[model samples]
Target: MNDADAQMIARRVREELARRRLSRQALADMARVSISTLEKALSGRRAFTLATVIRLEQALGVPLQKIPAASPADPLVASPDNLGAYSQNAVRWLEGRYLTLRPSFGTPGDIFAYVTIIQWDAEQGCLVFSEAERLDSSFSQSGKVSLPHLSGHIYLVTNVEGQYRLAVLGRPTIQGALYGILTTLMVGHGSQLIPAAAPFVMLRLKAETEIAFGRIEANHPDYVRYRAELDLVTSDGFAHFPK
Candidate 1:
């Protein structure tokens, strides 16, 4: 890779590590490499080989290509026209219904699969999503949009409650599935917002027929079936999805 590309990769790696709250030693173990080797790569003292890159990608639950390249300018702080362009691009890619795989609160080894609908909010100039079945409910919801940066485009989403659940969505893979890391700002011991992060993925469910949304509850049989079809992976296995 060129120097610019190498720098970009380093930035992406550091960001991913921070987002997932992974220690260098932990990532080295997961990647089956020594901590020193990983450090050298990160520090640009050693170039990353294809094999090493693949291993790191697998370990981090992120594709190397999904990590954006460094940008020449800050996209979010640009002119109104530039911002509009970024928002439009984001809306086009993200405005749709998705079956989200969320960590199940009651079951430690399972995921909660539910339908969510994303619509464009003209006033907000961003895309908003809510539980497809519970459109009128008071539960917190998330919105997503495209943000421009040196690396091209990044998708950011947030759900507001007492704090916020923010996630950065990666590029879709060959199977059209999306994966990314989630971080939440929560009230801590001192009534301050502390951030915690985890990885997640969302798969698009075929919408040939209208889906029944609001009727499915946590204890419902359909909910059980949905969970059954979804293969629950450990936090480190966030990027893996069953076809």
Candidate 2:
């Protein structure tokens, strides 16, 4: 995530904790997280994971989706003559949705989350989700990245002109498959498909641009497929559907 977006999430998390009159200790206890870990999450010192975000939401009884994100890059500020490389206009776009499900393989278990991007929507004359990627059984040691854990999934999204571009990040996995499906679906009838692979979640699009940002659906179709598979792995109340 960009600094602008990271800061926004951090501020939102802090505000919610305060609004509910929840002290750091109470929050950590309620979320089953350590105080220091909660501090990093709330301060944006660490990458915001869906696992931690959900815990906070449940504790605060609020949704992370409600958090306000910075608007797409501003044109006037994007020109090299007017701004530096670190400006908002130079930042990329990426939206993530995390779902915590039951343990399927190991002691640490797995944390599920879908990472999606804004692919150009030709028919709609804008950008829409090309796909929602999934990390079904990715393990997170002790529910933190400080120790042994998986990279999960990562990709890029860019806002060029009035449209946002999608960049599938490398090789095929459930994540890439989802993006591929979304790219095809969003451009179903008439649309230009520009398939590019980017390193990390960085957008190399032009400076100033705006696009509607977000995933097309609350739970993408692949999620449904994952749920069916998960049912056989974990019994009863362990598995869940996003609400």
Candidate 3:
């Protein structure tokens, strides 16, 4: 979204919050987004992504970004549909610690490397994923895994009151490589964030000894190998991007 549209949405959100007599912290908790991101966007230092706006709309029980400022879908629903309804047995194969790689949003010519552990949530009766070993641990994500049968795709979805970040990947290759795309806000020069997206690769890790985590620069030994893996997201048809 451009600056103007983003500012307009921010204005609407402020109005809705005030009209509802809601505190920012309460809304942030309900939406499950970091307080920092919410403050930045609301203060106009950053732009709101559609996912975030939708989340906020859902949380506030009203529409903000979309004009007519009205929605046919009921906004008063207590919560989103349970995305983790798949059986444990059906998703057991996906549990593991994966070396997650994608281009860095803050740095050019570098790859962001981290660990994503997918595990079975016995209490929730479904699969969930959490990130770790990230340089910015404060922004690490954890959310439910949605495995839809007909589409044969897996989704990692995180929703914050007015923000969301998602990744969709296909079945793992024989080599245990899962390729896909991620869409989320890119932290820019300052707190400013615009809608940004890039391909991501998730490789099942064999041992903690082999891979390194954090920002992998050109000089890092793992850079060459990690860069090649992310390339496969589009080159090998695992996902597509429109030019």
Candidate 2 yields a Cα-based lDDT of 0.37
Query: Which of the two candidates, 1 or 2, achieves a greater lDDT against the reference?
Result: 1
Error of 2 at 187 (Å): 62
Model 3, range 108-143, lDDT digits (tens) per residue? Answer: 889999999998775554667999999999999998
Q: Which candidate has the top score in TM-score? A: 3
Considering summed lDDT, which 10 consecutive residues are worst modelled in model 1? 75-84
Evaluate model 1: give its lDDT. 0.56
For candidate 1, the C-alpha RMSD (Å) to the true structure equals: 11.3
RMSD of each: 11.3, 17.5, 19.1
On TM-score, who's better, 1 or 2? 1
Candidate 2 wrongly placed segments (more than 4 Å): 66-243
Looking at candidate 3, the ten consecutive residues that score lowest on lDDT are 72-81
Clashes of 1: 3
Can you write out model 1's per-residue Cα lDDT over 19-107, one digit (the tens) per residue? 75668887787678889988998999998776677766555544454334426553332113333233333234455777665554334
Ranking according to lDDT, highest score first: 3, 1, 2
* Candidate 3: Cα lDDT at 80: 24
Best by lDDT: 3
